[model samples]
Structures are given as structure tokens and as C-alpha cells.
Target: MADLSTLARPYARAAFDYANENGAVDEWENFLFIAGAIVNDKAFRTWLENPAVTAEHKSAALVDLYDSQVAGDNDSAFKQLLGENKGSRYGNSISYPKVSPALNNFIKQLAEQERLALLPEVYEHYRHHKAVSLKQLDAYVTSAYPLTDDQRQMIQTRLAASLNASVVIHESVDPSLLAGATIKVGDKIIDDSMRGKLQQLKTQLTA
Candidate 1:
């Protein structure tokens, strides 16, 4: 497997710069979303990898697709720039070069090595890196009922005390949880939910 973080570093830095320079964080966000969609599409992936298709053709197709979906002031110019450079030699390359030349060159190097297929993983790592850089923690908490502000604040305080860092919580109501709350901080889950408690009881009974 590719070292996904290494693959994503340049791209992430490029995106950060692009978003910073243009004050277009929203644009970069949309751009990455579009790039991810294109990378994940089977037909697009095949076209990018197909040796029979000329680079020019693939590039043109990408330009059309991106121009239509990635709505922004400089989007058309971005597409034109991509078309001029020729489509990436790598099959997994994401055309998010609107913000940074260094990012474009980095991905181009990956393309030459035919490592473009790792773009999805790279993107994942990129998000994590960006989150860390911004001092933000991405977390999801699932609960059977909506947590009151007091309850949420208590949990946040506990998490901060335990993890030694403040967290911005993303909470969701999942009636399927039955009752109680399940807190997830990064990859760690504190499953205080009724479902989890029952499962533990069941396991212990069987044991």
C-alpha cells in the first residue's frame, strides 16, 4: 500500500495555500469535493487509466466535467490551465490545481509514476493533516436522543479533561441507539449507549 500521508502532503499544502491566498476556502472545499467525485467514479477512473485514449482526449473530458461541476469565478480558467498541461499521466490524479503550482507539480510527479490510483487515500490523509494543522478535531457522536446543551457541554468538558484538548463535537441523533450516548473522539469510542451496554451484558452472559 502507498504511504498515503506522504502522497497527500504536497496536495494538502497546495490546497491550504490556494484557500489562504484566494480567501476561497469554500472554493477549495468544492474543488476537493468535485475532484473526489471524479476520482471515485468508475468510468472516469477507467478513462484516466486507459492506454488507448490519448492524453489530450482525457484532458478535454476532464475539463468539460470539471467546468460543469466546479462552479466558481476562476473555474473555467482552471480548466483551461489543466487542458493546456495535458491530462495527468497517473490514473489516480486529482485535478485540484486551481490553487497551487507546487501541488500540481507534486501530483504530476505521482502521475508519471502511475500512482494516481492512490488519490482517494491521499485525499483522506489530506483531510486529517489539514484538520491537525488547523487545530481542529473531527469527531462524531451518536445518541438516541438529542443532547441538551448542558449534557453536551459536560461531555465536551470530560473529553477535554481526558484527551487534554478541546474538541468541537459533531452530534447526531440515532434513535437506533436506543438510549444513552456513544462518544467517538477520533478513532476511539466511549460506547455508553444502551445498545453497547446490552451487547456487553450478552457477551458476559455467554462467557
Candidate 2:
């Protein structure tokens, strides 16, 4: 099978384009995040996989789930859009009108293709697109202990300067590192951990 990211590229690109054209990238980002969470849930996954459940039921369940979550927000645009498209159909494809047109169309297409499970991958790709367009980077920082506000700010400042883009740091604690930290940006990893140093030393001695 193709990689999930590979499969998601076109859909993500389409969504990004639509959102960008309408200056709704952030809105789409939030929508996709919520939608992705819904489809990725264990209970929802099981329900989707059950052969006894029809596609219509799955789509309706998804629509209901999305509606309930977004309805309480002060922004009624999404709710109105969703309501307009309620029970709307495109030759067996479920439609979610009143919500953003682009998103509604995207959801309908996913339903038609039975590819709803790809939502998370699609959201990830969409986020990458959004970040690139905004000249931003997401940095993953792993350390022996939780990072302090100063440490996070310092790393963010340095990374922003180095990358020439705004940087968002996500921190994680991995005690197995023994000490020190590792920073990951895209495909690059910079490791300064004691464990990493020891491994390098062992390699040098063996060599």
C-alpha cells in the first residue's frame, strides 16, 4: 500500500488551496483537527469497520459528531453551513452544506471514496502546507526532563534565527536519555544527549 502521507497529499493540497483562496486556512486547520480526532477514535474506528454499518450511517454519525462539537461556539457559520447541507446527497455521497463549501465538498468526496480514515494524515499534510505558507516551523524537543519556560523560549529564539522562520516548540520528556536534549525539525535531528554521546564514543573506540 502507498504511504499514508503519499495518499493524503492531493486531498491535503486541495484543502489547502481552498482554504487559502478564502483566507480560511486557520479555520480549516481547526476543522480538520477536530474531524481527524473524531475519525481516529477507537469507538468510531470500530463502528466504521463493522460491515453491518452502512456508509450512510457512518457519514451521518460523523456529521452528527462534528455538529455537536462545533455547535456551542459563537461562530454559527459552521453550524449554518452544516444545517444547510443536512441530508443533502450527491448521487449517494453525503453532503454537508452551510459549513465551508470547500470542506463540505471535501467531506462528501471522502465519503464517496470511503477514505474517511485518511483524515488525520490529510490534516498533517494540510498543517505542513499552512506552516510553509506562513513561513513557520514546528520543532520537536525531547529532553531528560520537562523544559522550563526559559529553555523553551531560548530554543524557540535560536531556532527561529537559524531557520529564518517563526518556530513553535513542542516539548517531551524522555528519561532514558539520561541527560541533555534532542531537537527535531522536519527530517533533521540534533542530539546532544548523554546516551547519544556514549553511543558515539563507543563507535569511535570500536572504529
Candidate 3:
């Protein structure tokens, strides 16, 4: 099977192009960022994978989520159905007051094809596309735990200082790293995690 990123690229590009044509690239980026973060939750993934939830329901759930946040619909029925805002924890989101028809279809297609799980990958690809178009570099940060605002800023600042173009930090968590973090900027990767060091040591010993 193709890797998740490979499978997600076309979808990301389609969405990006659609957004660009409609003068909504930034809006799409913001939406994807929040959607990607929401899909990153383990609990939500488990729920989304449930066989009981239909494809339409899957798409509807996401649309309802955005609508509620954008419209301030305190009485959204789907919120109760989705679980106490399974996505409410994420902040700094750009709310969408009106979801475009193309955007709605995009989510629906992803759901119908059981590709919603690829959201994070799709978002990553979308970010790459957007950054390239805007002449910005993207830095990916993976850590054992979430970074505090100061930590994030420090990393962003340090990376920005090292790079020629403006850099944006995109973060994710992977507890299996055991400790510390890994940073990737374009082709360069810095593996500063305990797990990475252990693997390096093992490789040297085997050699």
C-alpha cells in the first residue's frame, strides 16, 4: 500500500488549487490546521474509525464542528453527539463563518473514501504546498510531549535565525521518542531524542 503521505498528496493539492482559485488559500490552511490537529487526537481517531459511524456522519461531524466554532452555535446537536467538543482543546483557530461548497465536498469525499485518517498527512502536504507558493520554509517539530508557548517560540526563533526565509513551526507529539525532540527543516533533520541516540548506538555496535 502507498504511504499515508503519498496517498494524501493529490487530495491536498486539489484542495490547495481550489482554495487558490477562490482566493481562500489562507482560509483553507487555517481550516486544515485545525482539522489536522483535531484528527491528531487518539481518542477521536478511535471514534472516527468506528464502523458504526457512516461516511456522511463522519463528514457531518467535522462540518458541525467548524460551524459551531464559527457561528458560536452553543446548541449544536452534533456537539452532544460528538462528545463534549472532542476538538475544543485546540486554540488559536481561524473560525469559518461559511464553509464553501467545494470545501464541504472535499471533506465529504475524504470521508466517503475512508481517508479522514489521512487528515494530518493531508494537512502537512497542504502546508508544504502553501509554504512553497509563499516562499516560506516549514519546520516540523516532533516531541515526546507538547511544547509550551515559550519553548515553541524559542525553537521557531532559533530556526528562523538559521534559515534564509521565514520559517513556520508545525508541531506534533510522539511519546515513543521517550524524551527530547526531533526537528526537521526541509531536507535537514536533527534527531535529539533518547530513542534516536539509542538507535544510533545500536547501529554503531552492530557495525
Pull out the clashing pairs in model 2. 81-97, 81-98, 81-99, 82-99, 85-97
Tell me the whole-model lDDT of each prediction, alpha carbons only.
0.62, 0.78, 0.80
Summarize candidate 2's per-residue lDDT along 24-100 as a digit string, tens digits: 88667767776787788898887778878776676666666666546344344444443443322222233323246
- Name the top TM-score candidate: 2
Model 2 score (lDDT): 0.78
Residue ranges of candidate 2 with Cα displaced over 4 Å: 49-57, 73-98
lDDT score of residue 103 within candidate 3: 86
Regions of model 3 farther than 4 Å from truth? 71-95, 139-164, 168-184, 189-207
Give me candidate 2's TM-score against the actual structure.
0.78
Candidate 2, poorest ten consecutive residues by summed lDDT? 87-96
Candidate achieving the largest lDDT:
3
- How many residue pairs collide in each prediction? 2, 5, 0
lDDT of 3 at 16: 91
